[model samples]
Target: MSNDFYRLSILPHVAIVIKICRAYTNSQEDFEDYYQEVCLQIWRSKDNFKEQCEWSTWVYKISLNVCLTLLKKKKNNYQNFASDSLPEEAIVESHAFADESLNQLFDAIRQLSEVDRGVILLYLEEKSYQEIADIIGTNANNIGVRITRIKERLKKLLDGKIN
Candidate 1:
């Protein structure tokens, strides 16, 4: 039973960890480091998962926390930062238009504040406003307004770059 539980409960989080690492880091080394850290955190916190929310939601919260902690640490040592190693296959599969324009968009997203990046990532992931709010510890109403503003900002930024 314990083995079964471990397989079912813990194994599924690997993909989530990968997604979070790719979203947060720029190089392969950094992604591996972040992914390991996230896995360690999830392992340590497994007992604390009360199941108050969906499993995916709980995993997302853990990933967010891990990413934020790493980001904070990296900010102090910016010069030593490594580039992210996003899987080329994943990018090709998900971003059918992985062109120069898309790369520019990603670069622009990296310029935004951490909170904004989180919000936009959740938005792009097709999460509902309520779900995003719940994940980020904000109210649904606020998330809705913020999302609209974020969309406008992203559009303007993209337009300026593309045209």
Candidate 2:
């Protein structure tokens, strides 16, 4: 059953899940834990998928919720640091990412608030503002405002101007 749903959700959206898990965790062990839990939850809830939105969108919602719930349970605000590199498979999965500078960009993005991180990740996936809003449960206008602010914040982080 898990394998069936994994093919339906995890295989295609694995990179998005990896990126979300990466931003929400600080260590490789924690990452693996989160990744597994997210996969488990997706399998657990597989039957509930209504096929209303794209399956990837549903996966994004589930992945973000799992990461945020785990973050809340751990009671730790994730750090404002970035990894020097990502897992090779994740890098290969992220076909949009062109160079090492894109890694710097993700580092900056990781410093954002959890909601901001979700918005930016969806935006990076080229999701419409409305799609992002629907996934994150906010208005499209609010998502637009948030994305604008998140971009400015990422700029500051990348410039070495922010602590």
Score every model by TM-score. Answer: 0.71, 0.78
| Residue range 66-100, candidate 2, lDDT tens digits | 98777433423234222233332332222224575
Assess candidate 2 and give its lDDT: 0.74
Worst 10 residues of 1 by lDDT: 87-96
lDDT of each: 0.67, 0.74
Off by over 4 Å in 2: 72-99, 160-163
For all candidates, the clash counts are: 7, 0
Q: Against the true structure, whose lDDT is highest? A: 2
Top candidate on TM-score is 2
What is the clash tally of candidate 1? 7
